[model samples]
Target: MNVLHLDTSALGTYSISRQLTAAIVGQLQRDGVASSVSYRDLAAEPLPHWLPNPDPASDNALRDEAVLQQFVDADIVVLGAPMYNFTITTQLKSWLDRVLVAGRTFRYGPNGPEGLAGGKRVIIASSRGGKYSGGPAAAMDFQEPYLRTVLGFIGITDIEFVRAEGVAMGDEAKQAALQAAHATIGELALRKAA
Candidate 1:
């Protein structure tokens, strides 16, 4: 099976989301599930913001085709999405614009919208600087909710999230959150086995 791993954190080595995504991909590899893995660091190789009317011959068009193809072809998708200010990174959003095509990922039926990109499992390694799962900041969290809505819109309902929150609180908090995320990843493996 093909695993598409996308990392969007700008911090590189210091990014907890990146670490978690790597571990998740490693676990998949060790489980003998992923026959091949494709890695894309969106932060380093950012796709240009998609234009409403794109030039078919432009470089961005070629890149968009390749990006969309990767998403459509992958059996599994792992995303390292660190909350930037409250939502996803612009780079990741740009990538989404390419993949969430009208006749590709979704379609507008007579009743409403229907998603075409189902059956694939998606795991998101989400990292946040503060505690947004609860507290007053919870209402302000647009990252996870937005991702869930958008991915669901594309028919990706078999989704899992490994979150490392309150990382910026302190060293202890960071470690604890990371440990929790790792535990979640382990549980995901068990679920996959079942």
Candidate 2:
């Protein structure tokens, strides 16, 4: 299987989401599930913020199409999504803008909008500073829900989140969250093997 691994964290080595995504991809490789892996560090080489361009042959349009083709060709996508101010990073959003194209990833049909890109699995390594999965902070969580909505809009229903939340709460909480995320990755590998 072809795996497209994308890291959008500006934290680099200190990023929890980056660590989780690396572990997840490693697990997939060890389980013999990934035949090839394509890695992209969005933080290091960010895509430009999209704008309307009438020229299809423009450099920006070409770059956008290339990014979209990568998404289209992948069998599985492993994304490192670090929550920033309760939402995804600007780098990731730029990447999404390239892929969520009209008649390419989705289209307007008789019954409304229809997603053309389907059958690929998306694994998101979601890292948050505080607990947002439940309780009072759940309402403030725009990260995971926004990701699900956009990805689902593109017909990717098979999505899984390996979350490592509350990392900034304390050292103990960070360790616990990492451990849990690692365990989830292992479980996913076992299930894929089965």
User: Which candidate has the top score in TM-score?
Assistant: 2
Choose the strongest candidate by lDDT: 2
Q: Write one digit per residue (lDDT tens) for candidate 2, span 50-120.
A: 89868989998888888899999999999999999999999999999899999999999999999998999
**Model 2 CA deviation exceeding 4 Å by range:** none
For model 1, how does the per-residue alpha-carbon lDDT over 45-122 read when each residue is reduced to its tens digit? 888777864587777677788899999999999999899989998888988999899999999999899999999899
Model 1: residue 96 alpha-carbon error in angstroms: 0.8
lDDT of each: 0.92, 0.94
RMSD of each: 1.2, 0.8
